[model samples]
Target: MAKLHIAMYPWYSFGHMIPYVHLANELAARGHRISIFVSKKAHSKLQSHNLHPHLITFITITIPKVDGLPEGTETGHDVPMELNHLLCDAMLLTRQQVEEILTADKPNFVFHDLAFWIPQVTKKLGIKSVCFLVISATCMASGIKPFREVTDDKPLTEEELTTPPPGYPSATVVLTLDEIMSLLGASDFSGMTKLHEGFTTSMSDCDVLAIRSCTELEGKFCDYIQAHYKKPLLLTGHVLPEESESKLEQRWADWLQGFEPGSVLYCAFGSQYVLEKDQFQELVLGFELTGLPFFIALKPPVGCTNIEEALPEGLEERVKGRGVVHGGWVQQTLFLSHPSVGCFVSHCGFGSMWESLVSDKQIVLVPHLGDQIINTRLLSTDLKVAVEVKREKNRWFSKESLNEAIKSVMDKDSEVAILLKKNHLELREKLIKPGFSSGYVDRFVQSLEELAN
Candidate 1:
């Protein structure tokens, strides 16, 4: 086999960027040359991770300013909820720059995430292009019908939007009308339209499709996508990063050390979601009801300077010695792998879900937005490895409901807990099987090499 040079562009969000970096590392380890193009702000975030300097190159693209987007916001995760579309619009503006760089570099192949314009440019340059999905196969599979059927002029009917797409599995999870409306409403509805356009164009123009999923976990969904699209689909197993040896900061580490092994619950919503003060208060009360030691890492809600201000008065003291609230950044993977951590109460982001799966932790899913709702449904309804916090009338959960879900998963003697633990362990074993994820990466590299030839 000959060494190949590949160019990669992912959506600006860290969730998308980090997986692309992981794939790049895997390819580089196999002796390939790789270039990753990202916005300047995104490049700064990537710098914190140890990437292969020799085999991988980081090319920074400037995000053009757009109305509603703050000056420094480069990714969806960095901005307020309503401004996400501006980030997408700004990314679209970089098409010209991306083309110029790719044209000069003249890489044999280009892998892109959600940048629909790339295929047109790559086509003109005669470079092979692959559309990379940074989300779950089930979610992607669910979208196939809508993307094919819905058009800019002919919008999806309310029923079409609410119902599962045709050919989706009978048990396929569909987002509620309210959840869909909330997702679109957050970005003023235009964001979803842009995304629909992007997916439609990219799927039509790309040479192949690649998704970050494994057959062991989502084989049926993967097969459905391949059969539906009539295109070659690559399943690049969940590319988990190597565990970090670095310990948490002294304060957090010392606090977690007080809990018995596998006795504490760790709660974290990924960096993107912000909770309302009322919702934050409910979560605090729910944790208090659990009576088990726990730690939560969250951003202070709007108008609050710190977690203490956002939390109910003296709630921290009430749960003193049993609960630790850390604001700002947390070493999530480290905490998930920590010996003292027993359960994870999470927003069910794909990255967080993968980390939980890799760590084999009991999960209490509380999906907040976007594909998280679908991911939660898949985990709880299809996989049955995690339990979802019960929602009231299909809306956000009450504190009592949250507490019940937590206690249900944490109780070792309960049948439901036993089953969840069994499933978690079984999944961990499957994922760790020799060459499980590596094999998928190897095959994907081989396909790219073939295209390069």
Candidate 2:
């Protein structure tokens, strides 16, 4: 095996970091030297995971306070929107520090999350840089196509929101008006700043692109990106562990022993997404009304006070033994795959969707910001494997709608629901087998081996 050194810069959340670490581990298994540069907050997880023993090294890079960013919060998600913008606005200022790190020991390649000024930093180092688009390749292609239009000074008028992009399945690859606004920052792009602007430029100039998704799921989009950009497009599948069926059964036996099979609706919104006080209350009432056994794995909004008390009246007592409320993290993959879980109520984040889809479980899509809505639409409309809840006033959803959506999918007799479960199982098996996503990961490793030569 060739001695190759690779570095990765991950987003500041568990979902993003977890996949980056997994990819790093896979690369390390190929006898490559890997260093993952992470923020201070993200450092704890890598340390706690004790991943270095698996053959990858962790490098902690501290982003000093600059341009009004709080001393402790390094990544955008750590602080509120305003501060996130402040830090991103100052991306140019962080260039010096990135330069310093690159000067010390430049790796053969750098893999960067789509945050910060990654592309700019790579160009400065004269090294090959590949963006690890951790989300679906379809979303990446959509983002890039619109970006090209925007860069050419042909800003898509507000009317173009409904018009589907040519050469893709009808409505399979479309963005809504609100989504378009969020992307263009009509309502003050809470996540945009000078730093973001610089970073986008870097992505446009990157040497290669890799997404943590396989062609089996996004073949059309994958082919489009390769043909349009003429750059090597790499897919690493979902890169999650293939937990044995027996292993999952035993774990479920421990946590879901008393609950009825296919009765409990598992609700988890992933790491991001914060429900306003009103919306949170509505959800609690909706769950209670459904009267079904349930489990909620939540990382509450960063600063919510006394989570149990925050629920609607009598919600905690009614759902008492029948419900489980978790504030911190848990093994979601294992939990979702449990036979007791009838359906998944998710924030529609890619990771959560992957867990739900790969487990062959019915899904209830409740999306918030970022690529969430796009993924939800893909599942609900294009994939026909999920049920979606309509958003209210572009803000919050109602309890009644939420309850109905849950019931519809949880009802096994419903043809759509039954079909979804079967389709998901088939898709899951394909992804795991040779000549599919797992195969893609193998190909990626082989390419890296060649690159090292």
Candidate 3:
């Protein structure tokens, strides 16, 4: 294949940027030149993920300041979910900047997410604009469907969301009352545009559509999206590095070494979402109830300044030796790769979901967002490789439910546990078979090449 120059414009969150970097690396390794756009701050953090720095360029995006955001707040890390729209509005403010860059640089293709207007700029500049969604096809098919375009301003009622959107693939993916209420709380994407508008418009107008998923994993959903969008929808097949180069931090390595192989549990929600104080307490307390050693790394919960400050009384002392509730970041791959970590409790973010699937660790999900909820259902229901922690009517997971999900998997001899283990291994092997991911990347690049010509 001839060398291709591609531009990547991912959303400002690490969840979005990191996957774009992975794809950039994949393209770069195959002798393609890549330019990735992110804010200066996000670029600083994302620098390490770029494996082929020589072939891949990081272009700093200048985020225009908005009223509600702190003077220098360019990404979501600096703000709460309630204040995220300001950042979204700020990201949209860069339409001129993005337009200028694409016009001048003139890459063959520009892969973007959430910036609905990029397609217009790319089309004007004779560039192939691919809306490379880092989310699952399941979420895309269910949320943004083949039917009418849902406007940004309409508020969805519980009745509307509890059932899947029109022409959605399956009955297995309906939302719970709790999920519906949570969606209502978090629906607005600020004064600029809603996520539905961004996704639908981006998909509808783009020259090509690509998803960071595979037909092997979400075949029906992928097919549905392509058939409806009537565009060149390419699957990037979980564009992740073959191996993590970073080492396990010494502190984590030492602590994990104390436990027997496949004995400890490692729980983490991704950086963006934090559990409520009560739910956080229940989670750690549930670990204590397991009577097994666990390492849980999470940000401080609501109303608390630190993990220790939020713990239930006497619970820390009771589980001191066996449990660690760290409030800082840990290298998740190292934790998952460790022999002692037998079970993983995750939030089922797209990235976390893939890591969970590729590892031997038993899976337990506690999803918080819309995409996460669908991802959890996919893993727990269709794949049957994992189990989801049951949520109460109020949408909080209790210590008992947490303990029960872990126990259901940790008890290897039990029928349910055995079934999950067997199914997980089978699926993992099939997905990661030699050339599986790279093959998809190759085909994705070819599709973009065809579109570019």
Model 2: what TM-score?
A: 0.87
Rank by lDDT, highest first: 3, 1, 2
TM-score of each: 0.94, 0.87, 0.93
Q: Tell me which of candidates 2 and 3 scores higher on lDDT.
A: 3
The pairs that clash in candidate 2 are 89-194
Return the number of clashes found in candidate 3: 0
Tens-digit per-residue lDDT, 1-453, candidate 1? 779888998887787898899988888888999999987778877875536789899998888889877767778777765566667788789988999999899988899867888888988998988888877888777776553344569766767667777778746477776777554325434566666567657876888888999888889888988887788888788888776778787887888888799999899998867788888888888998889998888988777888878888888779877987878898999888789999999998899988888886899999887678878888898888999998888477888998999999889999999999899899889998888878888887887777677
What is the Cα-based lDDT of residue 343 in candidate 3? 96
Of candidates 3 and 2, the better by TM-score: 3
Candidate 1 vs candidate 3: the TM-score winner is: 1
Judged by TM-score relative to the true structure, which candidate is superior, 1 or 2? 1
Colliding pairs, model 1: none
Tens digit of lDDT per residue, candidate 3, span 189-306?
A: 2321355567788889998888999887899999889988898788889887788677899988998899999999999999878788878888888899899999999999988888
Q: Compute the lDDT for candidate 1.
A: 0.82
Q: How many backbone clashes does candidate 2 have?
A: 1
Off by over 4 Å in 1: 146-155, 170-172, 182-189
